[model samples]
Each structure stands twice: as structure tokens, then as C-alpha cells.
Target chain A: MSKQTVFLVGATGETGESILRALLDDGSFEVTCFIRTASAHKPSVQRLKDKGLKVVFGELSDSTENLANLLVGIDTVILSIFAFDVGVEASLIQAASMARVKRFVPCGFGTPCPRGGVMALRDLKEVVHDQIFTLHLGYTIIDVGYWYEISSPRVPSGKFDYAIMVPRNKVIEGGTAPNMLIAKKDVGAITARIIKDDRTLNKRVYVCGDILTQNEINSIVEEKTGEKLELTNETTADVRKDLDQMNRAVQDDPSNLAHKYRLSNAQYNLSKYVRIDNTPEIAEYLGYIDGRKLFPDYVFQKFSDFVNDLAAGRVQRPYPHVSL
Target chain B: MSKQTVFLVGATGETGESILRALLDDGSFEVTCFIRTASAHKPSVQRLKDKGLKVVFGELSDSTENLANLLVGIDTVILSIFAFDVGVEASLIQAASMARVKRFVPCGFGTPCPRGGVMALRDLKEVVHDQIFTLHLGYTIIDVGYWYEISSPRVPSGKFDYAIMVPRNKVIEGGTAPNMLIAKKDVGAITARIIKDDRTLNKRVYVCGDILTQNEINSIVEEKTGEKLELTNETTADVRKDLDQMNRAVQDDPSNLAHKYRLSNAQYNLSKYVRIDNTPEIAEYLGYIDGRKLFPDYVFQKFSDFVNDLAAGRVQRPYPHVSL
Candidate 1:
């Protein structure tokens, strides 16, 4: 049988790198990475090229006709672009439709956000989802809760930085609610399996490595590292106050780039700590198939294991800086 | 004070004509109508031009740069385009933002649809609304209820056609749900007042000329026209059946244009007769300000008055055919 050809965008980012790695390691499908001309000469992109991964140079701002020509004969297209670049997805999706791609996997690798939520980011994501559905394009939407790398306690070593992660010793609102978390590598492996399986076509696939609250996560880090970190409880009211201030700032100056970024940061934190709508039950209610149920034999890396890796300095920093 | 400069799209459309007439009659704004090259020479377009309305030849498919150039010096931009043309609104909106227009009124001149309804058309409209809000542009969203011209009993003289309206002498469900109704002229006048009021800035304005059930409307028409039209009840189950069949056709052949149009028509019917989300109470809960409350002194044309007009042959068919 001929190998399936996959086209990937945003291949230099952390999640995109993991996906590219897994697809390459699977060795069953041909993989192509779409990179911006500015990033075409990076060492990481050069490494992928050396590994026999085909690279295409182009920008998302390119015309739909041009992008469609680049997507000819591609079986599936995976998007792992940044959230801020979401507005451009319309033209890309239209290009995919014009190219007659078999399936589309959009960049929705986050919590299960119901429509009409407080997060404008999720609303923007929903627009992309709706557009694909309206066009009758075959799609598999994957949302893998929060990343353990971001939710875990920050390593004290100066080698790694946590720009947007929660503070080191803060527990948000008793932190008893069970939140989903996954390793980035698992997201890649699951995505690889999902794309190869016909059962996941035109469905939402929810992936989770472990379900742990903020307090439980902290407990694992403390037990694994023996650091005796002191924790403080931050009330939901405080979070609401901060979010309100950020919202007002954006409202007062909608065109201010800095204020918009700060507002998005506040909204991200709210989705992680204050919103309880991302639970497994809610996901099921929203018609998502559990990834664990789909691939029961595959073992998942636990949060405790990640904590041990951080304590032993065995975990490499994925990126220099993470934006919310 | 100087008159506000307005740029209008869909000027030849029925709703757009009313809005244009209202704005021109108010004498408070200078209006420019954007027309496609094909429509530029039409008699309707000629009439608008004869009335001293500035006419610009352009298409929605125009590039954002080109559209922005046409919008230069315009204070507010109003869209009254058809639902199928919604995908083109993004570029036009981006152009408006680039031109730094003070206010934008999107093409939402229909029922007050809440987010995440059964209607795909409404979902598309919500995407436009979200885009405007995300851009932080000055805007007001307007949703009038069902149009009296479309929902009223058909005139018997064969002067008008009801291709997409409810079948003659038929009542949907119990026909007791108080649906909002407005004349096209009222939509125009209310929109004119809304665009001029600072209190409606960055808000949703719900407009209604009257609120009546299908049964009440039938009785009024029968008494006024004295044409004993027998009414048959169409159950909600039958409507759901039709909608489900249309949905399956679209799903089976998403690329079929005919199937898509049929599905849209079924969805429009379902939204009008099956959904209860367009009520004034629901709109209020969704944070919409009532237009009647905003302008209590302006007498609106009631449904009864519209029935009398139909009986007297004083009403004109706004368009040859209304597409769902």
C-alpha cells in the first residue's frame, strides 16, 4: 500500500515538534513540514530536513490559490499554529477544501471549551471548527487538557524558565477539582494514532494522561523532590478581580497590543483555574471520545513521573519562552 | 453639526432599501451605497443614484486593501448582505477596521438568535459578531424579529408569491409562541436611530413592531380580508422530520450546492417555528436593549395594519424572489 502523505504547519513549535517527531518515528507515513521563510534556515528545521522530512517555505498570509497548489495530493493537514494566528486559518481551511485534502486536524490542543464561554480565544477557535463543519470537510478535533510541563511546579534550576505558568507556591481556590493533564509527547503519539485510524474521523478526540488538581500536583512535586515548598491559597474572587482589571484595560484601549496580550493572559489563567467546564464528564457530554478508551494498550506518562524528571534535571526545556 | 458619512453594502436588498430610505429621510447622514459592477447598471441601483446617493462599484470578493480604500472617510459601515454571502464579511470588516470607521452594523437583521442554537446560519452570524468584538471596533448588533412581509398571510390576487413562507392555510405547532415581528420600513428607521445614538454603542439592539402568535395572525387576516381560509396544524414532529432529512442530505453530499440550499431553507423554517430562543425575554437575558424602550414615541406599523395593507393591495412585493 502507498504511504499516507501528511502536511504539517507550525512544525517548529513545541507541540508541533512533538507531532513531527512521532509521525517520523512511526515510519509508515510520509511527512512534510510547512515553515515560514524566516524560520527556514533554523538549526531545528535543518535537522528535520536532514532526517528526510520534506520542507516547504511559505507564509500563512499567502493567497488561497497559492496555498491550495502547495497542498495537492496531501491526505491530511495538521495545524499547530499559535492562537493569535487563528484568524488566518479561514484562508488555509478554504485552501484545504479547494485542494480536496482527505482530513483536517485543526490547532485545538487545549481544554474542552463550550461555546459562549468567558474566553475569547475559545470563541475564536469555535469559529474555525464551525467553518470546517460548514464546508463539510472531514476533520478530527483533538483537545488534550493542560500540559503537565506547564502545570507542574517550576524547577529551581536557572536552566529552565516558566513565563506563563502558575506561581511556584500558589493553590487556586482549594484546587480540589480534578483537572486533566497530558505530556506533550503523548499528545503527539495519540495524534499520530488518531490520524491513522478511520474510527476517529469527523469526531472530537479528548486526550488526558492524568487528572489531578493543583493541590495534588503540588503534593506530587513536594513528595518527589523533598523540597518542602510552602503553598498559599488564592481565592477565585482575586482571580476575578485581576481578570476584570485586564478586561477593562483592553476595553479602554482595544487597539493597544500590550493590553490585548495581558487580557489574553488573564483569560488563559481563568480557563485553567476558575472554569470547571473542562472535566472529562463535560467532554463526554459534549460528544468527545476518550483517547484512553480508544488506545487502552498504550501506557501514558504520569504526573508523578514528570515531577521526578524535573527533580532529577532530566527534562529538557521545550522552548525558551512560552506565551499564554 | 455636520452629517455623519455612512457606507452601505447590499443597498438593493429589501432590508437595505428600507435602511437607506430611513437614513436619507432622516436627513442626518450622508450615505454611499456600494454595488457590484453587475448591479451598478440595474434600475434599482439607478433609482438610488437618482436620489443623490453616492454609488461605488465594487464586490465583496475585493481585497481588503481595495475595500479599505473605498471606505476611506466613511464614519460608519452597515452590512445588509445575504446569509450565504457571510464568508465575505471578514475581508470587508478587516477593511472597515483598517479604514478606522467609527461604527459598524453587521448583517444581523433577523431574529435575536443566541449563541450555539440549532441554526447553523445563526452560528455563522455569531462568528461575525465575535470578530467585531475581538477587534474592539465600535459596533452595534441589530436583530429584528420575523418580517411581516414574509410571515403575513399571502395576498390572494397572485400579486405576491410565498415560495419560502409557511404553506398557505397552515399553522406551525400550537402557533401560540409569541414571535416578534417587524415591517422592513421599521427595521430601517430603527436602524437609523440606532446608528445615531451613543447609548447603543457596543450593544445589541432588539427591534420589534409587534409580538403575536400564528393563530392570532390568522384570525386578524381572516377578519380583515373576509376570506375564510381553512388552517391546518403542522406538528413540530413533521418539521423536525423535514429538517433531519435536509441535514442528512447535506451530510451525505456536503459539496452539493442544491443540498446545501435545501438544508438552509429547512434550518430557516426550524428557527422560525420550532425554536423559542428569539423572544424578548431571552434577548433581555442575553443582554440586549429593547428598541421599543429606546424610542417609545415612534409608532411602529403593527401586524394588523400590515394585514389591512395586504387586503387593500397597497403593499408592493419587495423582491421577485426571497432566497432562504
Candidate 2:
């Protein structure tokens, strides 16, 4: 069979880069990535181009006709842009549909943001999902929950700037609420495998590395670090109170970036992270018998491996993407 | 006491125009309506300006700094813009907050759109609500359900061009499911009264004329028009089936506007119109004991009155705003 042509937007971003690398390594599809010319000088863009991947330069808000022209003959269009660029992402969806792309994957690689909570990004993601549904594009939404790199305090990636689940010396909200977290590279591999899979078409797929509580994560961190670190337990109510204060701070100084950061972190703690007891229940909610059971052929990386990678200095400590 | 300086956005649109008229007639608030200069030559703008109404020309995406400067003395900001202008609305919310406006009333004049449900506009409204909540802006969300002028079949307002409730000879879906319908004028009057009322601050309010089924609306139309219209009953399941077909049609030919119209109408039938037995339950949802019991002093125009007004050529059947 002839190889399918895939167009990926935001290929320089963390999620985009991971997915792009995974797809390229698979060598089954002809991969093309759209990058902003403004960031063409970046080393990441040069690295991707050097890896024998096709690269195109354009703004996210490129005219629909122009975007459609670029998407010509592409079988799938995967948008992995920042959630805040919802308008741009919407335009891309329209353009992809206009170009008659058979499949479209939006940047929904987290919890299902069904409603707007304190996080504007989550709300915007919800809006994007709505737009995709209304446009009736042949789409697949991947809700992979949180990533381990940011949540694991041992690594303390720049992306985890919000002290959500710091390895030590942090208060974990709802410490015992079993939550799902996947390694970022694993997300890339899973997405690459599913892009052309018919089962994923017009559906939402939930994937994860491990399902464990914050306290469990803390235990894992201690085992890897070989040192005891301070850990505090905070109730959900305490987190909400902080969110309320952050909300006020945002209102008082709308331009303050720190207040926005605090508000974002507070919201993620209060709503965005999903807590599922077991794989079966989560799989049921995701419209499957069990995600792991369904994908028996694929093996996800373990949290211990992620911890070892952090200790060995193999994991990227400073995330290149903008903080959420 | 000096009148509150109210900055009104989209004051020339259907709901906005109605609210503007109500506020002007009351002569309580010093009303200022923001209008895009591209539409400055429109007769609506001229008419408002002719009536000594303060008209400011600017884009919705005018930098927040510029918008804040314009809103320096405004006590409240009321946004009744088209639902499709969500990006613009977000900018307005930020601008309003930056301006330190005391209260904000977003374009939540219809049903409450809590999440994305096959409707992009509803999802956008949800995002706007989230933005308002996150910003900690003092706000009032008015869920007035459906407007009688548009939803009533005998009067086919241009705004209801999507064939939701048509002028006779149409199958009404879920005819027995009760819904709250209010006159557009009443929405304006009620909103005008509540803009400055402390009771409405930071809360959602549901106001309605009558809670009745589509069959009842058809009966009222027949009673007023003195003509027995050909009406047929259809189930919500039938509507969902049509929506599914529309969804497929849109996927097949994404640019087909007709498919979009069909999908929009089907979604409206399935979700937009409220289904309730009585006012008290709806009141509970809107956080009130009972809307009627709470607002005993305000008299909402009856469905019979609406029908008579339509038959007597008092109701403006050709809506000035674009169709949803």
C-alpha cells in the first residue's frame, strides 16, 4: 500500500515534537510538519528538518485557502498547538476539512475539559472540541491525562512550573485520589500508532502510563531518590481557597503573569486532573473495556523507568515549550 | 443618586437592541453602546445616535488597554454580542475586568451552555462564562430560555430561519416537552431592572413568560391566527437521527451550509429549549426558590399576548440580527 501523507502542526512544541519524532521513527508514513517562520531560526526546527522530515513554514492564522492548499493530498492532519490558540486551531480544523483530509486529530491530550473551570486553557480546549464536533470533521480526540515528567518532582521539568506533584517539599491536594499519568514519549508513540487506526476515527481515546495516587507517586519518588523529602497533605478545600485568592489576584491585576500561573495551577489541581480507581472504570468512561486490555500489543513505559531516566540525566529537565 | 454609566456592546443586535430600548425608556442608567465603525453607517447606529444615545466606535479586539481607557468611567459592561464572536467576547471580558467595571452581563440571554454538545456556539458561551468566573468579575447570567418572537411558529422571525419553529406545516419535535418561552421585550425590561439591582449581582437568573410544550405553542398560534395549521408530532429520537445524518453530511461536504442549518435546528430541539414541569424546579437550577415567586412584582407578557402582537403586526417578524 502507498504511504499516507500526514501533516502535523506545531511540530516544534513539546507534544508536537514527541509525536513527530515517533511518527518519523515508525517510517510507515510520509510526515510533513507546519512550523511558524518566526521560529524558523530555532534549533529544534533545524533538528527536525535534519531528521529527513518535510517541513513547511506558516503562521497558525494562515488563511483557510492557503492552509487548504498546503494540506492538499494529506490523509491526516494532527494539530498539537497550545490550547490558548483555540481560534487558530479552529481555523486549522476548517482548513483540514476543506482540504478533504480523511482524519483530523486535535490537541486534546489531557483530561476531558467538559466545562470551564478556573482554567481558561481547559475551557478553550472544550471550545475547540465543540467546534470540531460542529464542523463534523473526521476526528480523533486523545485524552491521555497528565504527563509524568511534569507531575514527577524528581525531574522538575520546566513544564511542571506549577508545583502540582513535586517529588518532595510540596503539599499534594487530594493525595489519595488515584490519578493517571503517562510519559510524554509514550504519548508520542501511542498517537503515532493510532493516527491511521480506523478504530480511533471520530472517537476519543484515553491512554496512560500508570494509575496511582499522589501519595503513591511520592513513594515512588522517594524510592528512586534514596533520600527522604518533606511532603505535606492538603485537602481539596485548601486548594480551592487558594484558587479563589488567585482568582481575586487575577482580577486585581489582570496583566500579572504570576497570578495567571497561580490561577492555572490551582485550576488544574481542582478540576483538570482525572482520578480513576482502576483501568476498567476509566476504560469504560473512555468507551472501551479497558485501554490497557484493548491495547495489549503495546507496552507503556513504567513510572520507575521514568524515575530512572531522571536519575540518569537522560530526561529533558527543562521543557522547551511555554508553561501552561 | 447619579445614573450608572453602562457600557453596552452589540447594542444594535436583537437582544442588545431590545435591552438598549428598555434601558433608554427607563431613563435610569447613563447608557453607552459600543459599535464597530465598519457598521457605523448602518441605520440602527444612526437611530440610536438620533435618540441621543452615546455611541462609541471601536473593534471588539481593540487592545485591552485601549478598551480599558474607553471604559474608565463605566459602572457596568453588558455584552450581548453574537455567540460566534467568542474570541471578541473574551477580549471584552479581559478589557472589562481591566477597566474595573463593577458588573458584567455576558450574552447568556438564552439557554445555559455548560459544555460542548454538537454546538460550537454553546461551547463558546460556556468558555465565556468560564472566563468571567475565572476573572472574578461581578456578573449576572440571564438564562431566559427561548424567545417567543423567534420560537413561535405563526411569527417566523428572520432569526429563526433555521426551521426550528416554522410558520405552519412543520413537524415539531418533542411537542410534549415543556419549555420556557419569554418575549424579547420582557427580556430587555427584566434585564434593565436587574442591571443596577443588588439582588442580581454575581448570580444566574432565569426569567420566563410561560412554561409550556411546543404543542401548546401551536395551539396558541392557531387560536390567535384563526387558522388551524397542519402540525405533526415527532420524537426527540427522530431529531437526533436527523442530527446524525447532518453530521455525516457535514463530514462528506464540510462547506454545505444547508447541512449546518439542519444540524443547528436539530441541536436546538434536542438541547437549547429547556424541558421542565414547573417554574420552581427551573428556579432551583437557577438558584432561586421559584422565578415567578421570586419576581412577583414583574409581569411577563403571556404567549397569548405575543401571538396577538404578531397577528396585529406589532411584533417585528423580520429580526435585524443574523440567524443562528
Candidate 3:
């Protein structure tokens, strides 16, 4: 385990810096950064170098021999790179198996999926995820679901504002009160802790950075920014229509869908991860505290901060869902 | 042209071998083989080394760096490697563009496609093919219909025992030919010609090794071998039935249709490549005199030859397509 080396792709991206800092801050693991050039040296790589981690640069078109020099001693890999197709994950996994790399942590940092949730997908990530069953390497997808860092600002988001794509008008059959939200820095902290802990090895670690319900966030935003973030809580049919509308938007713009894995999920299961009671292993992970209990008031604080930002027009507006 | 170096993946695979021989035989092109070995000796590598082709091995899991080294001093690239995932082909093409490789030829060495043929597939290969539009590199996919290779006498094929998987009786709807067959040697020849020909530089060059029909092959086997061969035609419905039944059989069996890609293609349209008329490019390349004009006596001769082999037990009998 001490000999395991982690190769990081797209280390300069948004989420990469957190993982890089986490991995580098801990001295137990060795890390390698696969960069293309020193011409546009990323501060992260320099930081990793400054902190005594190895950095390598190479082309993806070159032969295996040419790149062999870089992967010589690597064991684990953390990939966050985004391309036109996330299906490249499978190829990378295949290559990793060929190279005899041991463990892999894919960029599945989504909500900790229910077992069935992962199986229902036929998307590129799902296809690649399925291949893991046939390969010899061990993989643990750290589903730090919908990081607080990346979610839409809920503060100033009110009646005039949309309900974060989920419906606000009708009563959700189950209602959306269970999920716990987490800050991105907390996600980074959890990631560092999980990897550093031998107990979590080969286990699906559900790290809800801060646990707060969508309802709580909404209420919090209404309180903080006084904006009514009206979710279209219509009939089931209407909810489905809205979900379809969102999905259609993503599909319409392939470049956008490609970037985010064509999200706009059809399930309308956005708040599904609100509760960590979903996983028995998760219950066991922290002695059954479940994520929400850990951060009881996460949404109100996060949403308030988000509303402050929205008031300043700090974040980009919702992209129009046009057909591709 | 003299300074143009070409990179070839799958250099030792069946199609790669042909492309390699074609590029090397041209004498005007420089060639490099990207292999999987890291300073390890492989039979294919030795052959290429003997022919003065540089060999570079790059892991698919690592960064694109290995490919970049070969990209330098290279102006054109013939990517015969089949990276069947979504972004891999695009990424490599993007790398080629980055490397400034002017001309790129993808491994599109199969029959010309209609709207729904392989061109419409969402698989990794199609994903890579789609990248052609996004990437600035000049690219062409040479579509060679099925190749018919003559087996050595020592390992000669017995009887007219060739198995072509088609979607039920609708095989003709898809690009795959139910009747037409191409010789393997001709496949090599045609692709070699396509690579060397300036006329097909940007277009799909199609070629058929021979214009023989499926029924003719079966009939010829009876005539040639002086034996009766049992033919089993599995319709798409029958295949689906079997596949559904053998869903459990695929767990341990390799030949089960339950898990085979062939079963999944039962709904595919296969008639396009079956008809020689659909492929004017290949028909032109072979100088077709038309099957109707030359087949009366020739069919009898070929059928008899195939039949004699079957009678002699030279050809292996096919398994019945019953669900396991």
C-alpha cells in the first residue's frame, strides 16, 4: 500500500486541486501528475512538485513504449479528465489492467448511488463502470454526491428563480427531506481520510461533505435571500415532463452533455442522496450517524452563502435546454 | 512526402499488417508501430524492426505523451488501432491535430454504411469516428467489404462451412451481405491499393474481394465435395428466443448467444453490403462483370468443390442454434 503511486489526469481542473492537495498533504501515498507540457505549467503541478510529488508529461497519441517511462512505478490512478466521451474511462481502465495497476478511483464523485441507480444507467460512465467486473484491478468510486462547492446557489434563488431544476410546485411523492449536503473542501477532507485509512480500502465510501436536505436549502434560501425558489411541484406527469425537458436540454447540446456526462438524469432522483440511511455500509462507516446528522444545518448556511453570490451575479445562469 | 512519417496502431493485427505492408511497400512513407511492449520483444515488432520501422509502446491508461513522441517527425498518421470507446479516438485525433499530423486515416476498413449501419452505432468506435468532424486532421475511412482469404492447403477449410450471423431473415437490410463475400487476400490488396491511391485520399474506398453469393457458396459446397451439408438458418426471432433462454448460459459458456455482440445485432439492417450494387466503389474496384453474367457454370464448379470437402469431413460442421 505504501508503494502505491497515484497518477492524476486533469489535475488542474476544478475538483482536481482538492484531491491533489489531499493526496499531497498526506505523506503515505506517492503521486504522479500526467501533464501535457511545461509550456503552460499549472500552479497545482508546481505545488505538487513543491511538495515533493513527481510530475510527468506526455502525449496520448504516442505508443505504449513512449509512455512506459511515465507509468513505470504507478499503482493507483485518480482520473478527473473530461473529454467528448467519458467512455474513455473504460479504455483507461483496460490500459490500467494491462499495465497491472492495482487500484482505481474514477471521477464518479457523484451522489453515492443506490446499487440499482448505478445499474440502471446505459451511459458511457455506466458502460465503463460495468467493465470493472471483468478486470483484475480494484476500484472504489468515491461518490461524494453533488458537492456543496458545485451546486447552484440557493440563497437568492426564490419564486422568480427556478427550483434547482427539480419541481417545487407539487408534493414530491416521497418529499425531498432526507439528503445531507457537504462543502467541497469537506469532500476533499473526506477523500483524504478515506484514502489514508486502510479500513476503507476496496469499499464504496459515501462522503456527503455536508448533509442538508433540498427542502432545507430551499427554506434557508427563502430566509437568507428572501427569494422564492419555486419548484414546479406539479403532477407526476408534469414532473416527468419537466425532467424530460431538462434531459432534452442536455441532449440537445452534446458539448454541454459531454462535459457533464449528459446529466439531466431522467430519474428525477436528484434528492435521492439526501439520506445516507440508504446504505448499510455507510451506516457502519461512521457508526450509523448517517451524513445528515453529521452536518445538521448544512443547507441553510450553504444556501445563504449561495444567495449572497447569486445577488452579485457571481455564478453563471442556467443554460437553456435546447435540442442538439 | 519524404519527411512524412506515419504512426500505425494494431500494427500486427490482421488489418494493421496489411496497412503496414502497404505503407512500407510504398517506399515513400516512413512508418512507426505503436505496440504494447516496453522494450519487450514481440514477433510483430521484430518483423517491423527488420523492415526498419521504429517501434514505440504506449499504455492506453497513461497520458497521451507516448503518442506525442511519435507524432513529432511525422506528418501523416494511419490509426488502424481500434479504440472502441467514445473519446479515445477523438482524443487521439485531437493529439494528432496537436502533433500537427496533417493527414489521418482511421481504421474504417469495412463496407460502406447506410444511415443505420455501423455509422449510427453509439459504441466507442463510432465515437472515435465521429471525432473526425471535430478534429481538423484530414481523415478517410476505407470501407472494404468482408475479405475472403484463401487458406493454405495444410489448413484448408473443409466443405462450404462458413457461418455468417445475420439478424433473422432481415440480414439483407443491414450493410452486411448475406450473399456477397470478399477474399481475405483481396482485402489486403484492396486496402493496400486504397492506402497508396491518391484518388481515395479523402473518400471511402470500397472493394469486394469476390462477388459470390451465400446460396452459391452452400450450393457449391454440395457440388464440390459431393456431399449434402445441413444448413441451419436462425431468424432474428429464433435468436432472440435462444438469447433470452440462454441468459443464464452466458455465465460460463463462451459460445452462448446470450452475451455475444452477434445476438445484440439481430435487429440490425444487413442488406446493404449483401447487394453488390449498393457498393459501386467496390464493384468498380473488382471490375465486376456482374454475378448474373458469369455464375451459371462457375457456381456449379465452386459448389461441387465445397461439397466434396464436406463429404470428406474436411469442413467442420456448425452447432445447432438451439437455446442452451
Candidate 4:
């Protein structure tokens, strides 16, 4: 069989690189990555170039014509890029469908939305996912919940106090959500395995770490480092109420447009996925990850794109940049 | 009070021109007519130019940077351009608000979609209008119900052979639902009048034509013509059901996206303000155009734009472009 060209968007991010690495190991595929920003001085991007992967840099809102060129012969695509909760996903997916790309892997590193309370992920998702299904594109979503990488950045020990930003304030305090800390490599392996597995077609699956509930995950932190991790549960609901209030306030103050947009996006992304209790699912994926030998890509392209967006200044104030 | 410099979009369309003429007569506004298709033909644009109006040509797409110049020193704007249900209206309104234009008028030239049960129109009203209000743009809607010029273009001739298109395809040979007919000129007048009237701010007002109940319209036709005017009243229910069915069919057919857009638009325009069993509000604005007056400069501006659009092929099959 001829080798397939799999276009991976957002290949320059820390997590996206892992996914790209796994896709590269597949003998039957050649991978191309789309990035919107590239700094030659940046170590990660230059390293990616050294690996000999094709990288095309362009904005996320690139029109249909530009997309048609990138999609011309690609057999499969893994979308890991997103905007700040706008109609970008649906628009990009529609463009890809028009370009006749064979299969699409949407940025679904969370529980499936339908399995949740039919709550909208973002306003765009309400409009977009419907557009995706209605457009009749063959799609598979990588349901690898939240990434530890984004939330758990390393800082000098005791130099900085621990503070975690939750979607809003949660029910149970201190990390009640299950977080099976699957090594990045394990996440990578699962992604690569799915591309080769026909059974995963048109499906949404979980990829996680250890079988750990929110409490267990916190315990694991204690056990590993012997330093108690400060815990916080931020319920998405409280955040939404705050955002709704902010939106009302914004109507009276045009100056608050950006802030309202940010809050709304936060609420949308946090609530978009299936409301998995996560303890069982995280354990299940953690077991699966432990059983695997080689690392698989965790489909971190979207996160990677998020990084490029920050580096290029398309988006001001990253989550890390925001104090509150 | 200083006169406001108003920029009018789609000033050449039926209602748009009316709005322009009304504003022109009020003597409190300086109008800049936005001409989309007259880029190369300055003399063609000169029809408005001769009347001492400024004209600028460009596509009305959301990202048209040229609009920045038009927005400069522009105190108010009237957007009348329509695309086959695209996402540009709110984006443009936001742009206007950002430019600090004091007042904006939306192209709400139909039975207020709220009263009308057309889904596409309803969707447009929700998404577009909500976006406008969010932008904090002071706006008004000229809620004209139906165009007399667009329907039954030639009045009942002596023979009364002219055909009328109704939502009901299977009505009894002679049933009558109310037919509210406003000439294109009246639509323009209502649009023009809305922007100038302080009472119109933050409000939507209905513009109706000579309101004759279905039987009255047919009888009037019979009175004017030597032969009996055929009377057909498709019950509002049957017409709505048919329109809903057509809307679903059009939405499903991707290849016919543009055509479906037009059909749904027509269905929306025709279904509303049929005086289902009550008062037709045409009486409110009937006095606005008591006589066929001179070639109002604004009306001429519209005619000129239509000629330009026709010549430039911009008038390609309009949505619901009736074959009649």
C-alpha cells in the first residue's frame, strides 16, 4: 500500500511534538505539520526541522483556498489547533471537508460532549460539531481528557507557592477530578496505535494515567515528591455564573469585550466534554498506558498550536500569564 | 446640533434607497453612499455624485479593510447589504462600534423576524441582532413586511392575467389570506425614515404597504381590470408547513446552498405580516408615501446601484430570485 500523508496541525508545542514523533514511527505514513508561528531561535521548532518533518506555517483562520493546497493529497488529519472559543473549529473542519481530506481527528482531548449533559463546549461547538456531522466528514476524536503537561509546569522547588487555576470553583476541594498521570510517552503511543487500528475509526476514546481519583491523584503527588501538593477544586458552574454576570456588565461597557470573550471561552471549553467522574476512566487509561511498550502521541497538536499562538502574540495573556 | 455624516450600505436596494431619501429630505444628515460594484465606473457612480453624494465601492465582506477609510469621520451607518446568510453583519457592526460611529441601522427590512416564523430569518435575527446589541451599537430596524415592487411587478392589467405567488400550493381555487404590498420605493423610504427619527432609536418599527385583506386585494384587482381577478388564499398554516418543509430540504442540500438560501429568504419574506386574521400595520406608514413623487435623489442612487450591479454581474441569482 502507498504511504499516506497525515497532516498534523500545531506540531511545535511540547505535547504536539510527542504526537508527531509517534506518527513518524508509522511505516505507512508520512506526516506534515501546520504551524502558525516559527522562531528560528526557538529550540523546539529547530529540533523539529532537524527531524525532517514538513512544517507549513500559517494562521488558524486560513481560508479554504489555502487549506485546499495543504489537504490536496493528505489521507488523514489530526486537528490540534483552536481559537479562543469562536467558530474556528467548525470553519476549519468545513474547509477540510471541502478540500476532500479523507479522515479528521478533531481536538477532542476531553470526554465526548454528547456523553455530557448536551452542554455546549463553546458557542462555536454548538454551531460547529453540528456543522461537522451535517457536513458528513468522517471524524474520530481523541478523548484524552486534560493534559498534566499544561497544568503541571516545573518551577524551582519552594521558590514559588502552588496555585492551580480551575475552570471555576469545584464541588470537592483540592483536585477532585481523576488525573491518571500517564507519562507523555504513553499518551503518544495510544495516539499512534489508534491511527493504525481500524476499530478506532469514527470513535472517541480515553487515554489516561494511573487509576486515580482526584484524591488519589493528590496522594500520588505526595508519594512521588514527599511534598504535599496544594489542591483546589474549581467548579465550572461557578465560573459560568461569574462569566454570565461579566457578560451583562460588558454589555454596558464595551471596554469589557475582551474580558467577556475570555470568560465565555473558559466556560465553553471546561463544560464541553462528557461529564466523566474520571476516577474509573482515568484508571482504565492509566492501566492501558502502563501496558503499552513504546510511547504513542497524545494528540497534543492543539496545545502546541496554543503555544505558537502565544509566542506570536495572536492571543494576549496566556493562562500562565493571567494572575487571577 | 451638528449634522451627522451617515454612511449607507446597500443604498441602492429598494428599502435602502428609501431610507436614504427620507434622511436626505430631513436636512439634518450628510450621506455617503457606499457603492459596491461601481469601482471602475465613476460616471455610473456619478448618478449619486451628481446629486452631491460621496460613493465608495468595495465588497461588504467582514474583513474588508477598505471599510476603515469609510468609517473615518462617519458618525452613523445604515447597513442594507445581504449575503446568502453569512456571518458578516455582526462583524461589521462591531467594526462600526469600534470606529465609534454614534448610531447604526441594521438591514432589518422585513416583518420583524420575531413575528415571522421563518427559521433562517429567526436565526439571523438572533445571531446577528444579538451580536449588534453586544457591540453596544445604537441601532434601529426598519421592519418593512413585504415589497409590492418585488411581488406582482406589473399591477393587475385590464385582463388580470398576472399571477401571484403564495406559500400555499394546494389551497382551494379561491381562498384569500391577507397580502401586504409595499412598493420598493416605500421600503427605501421607511429605511431612510427610521435612521433620522429619534423615536426609532433602539426600536423596531413595522412598515406596511396598502393593507388590503386577501379578498380586498383581489376585489381591487377585479375593479381595476375588465376580467375577474383570480383569488387564491393559501391558509397561513398550509403555507407555513410548506415553507418549513422547503427550508429543511434546502438546508440539507449542500450543492444548492446558495439557491436554498434564496428560497428560505423568500419563504421568510412572504410568510410574515399576511394579516393572518388581524390588523395589518400598513396604516402606520401609509402616509409616508402618499404620492409617486419626483426622482428622489436617494431613489436615483438606488437605481444607479442596481444598474451597476446588473452591469457588473453582481446581481446574479438573488436569494429567492422568483422566475416571474
Q: Who wins the DockQ comparison?
A: 2
List runs of model 2 lying over 4 Å from the truth.
A154-168, A252-258, A272-290, A318-324, B1-324
Q: Write the per-residue lDDT of candidate 1 for residues A81-104, one digit (tens) a residue.
A: 987677687777889999999899
lDDT (Cα) of model 4: 0.52
Report lDDT (Cα) of residue A14, candidate 1.
Answer: 78
Which digits, one per residue and each the tens of the lDDT, describe model 4 over residues A1-324? 788778887665544656787777656678887766644446766777888878776665777777777788887878655433335655567667888877777665543233212233423443554455444566655655455433332222432223333322122434444433344444555777776665555444565554334555444434444555554445566556666776676677856545655564444334421133333333232111222222243333333333233233343222443443
RMSD (Å) of each candidate, 1 decimal: 17.2, 15.6, 24.8, 20.7
Which stretches in model 4 have alpha-carbon errors above 4 Å? A1-324, B37-44, B62-66, B83-86, B115-117, B151-181, B232-262, B273-324
Task: Locate the minimum summed-lDDT window of 10 residues in model 3 chain A.
Answer: A282-291
Superposed Cα deviation of residue B261, candidate 3 (Å): 17
Tens-digit per-residue lDDT, B11-119, candidate 1: 8897998999899899999999999998877899999878887999988888999999999999999999876677578888888999999999999888865455467
Candidate 1, chain B, TM-score (2 decimals): 0.91
Pairs that collide in candidate 1 are: none
The best candidate by lDDT is 1
| lDDT tens per residue, model 4, B220-252 | 434444344433445556555666676777778
Q: Candidate 1 - CAPRI tier?
A: incorrect
Poorest lDDT segment (10 consecutive residues) of candidate 4 chain A: A285-294
lDDT of 3 by residue, B1-324 (tens): 354577777777666776777666666667777776663486657887787778877754445565565578776677655423224454567678777776677765554433222222324444454455334346555555443322111112332334322212222222134433454334444544455545444343454434454455544544554555444454445545644544444456756543544333322223232223235433333222232232222221132344354345554322234231
> What's each prediction's TM-score?
0.53, 0.52, 0.40, 0.42
- Model 2 score (lDDT): 0.71
Worst 10 residues of 3 chain B by lDDT: B150-159
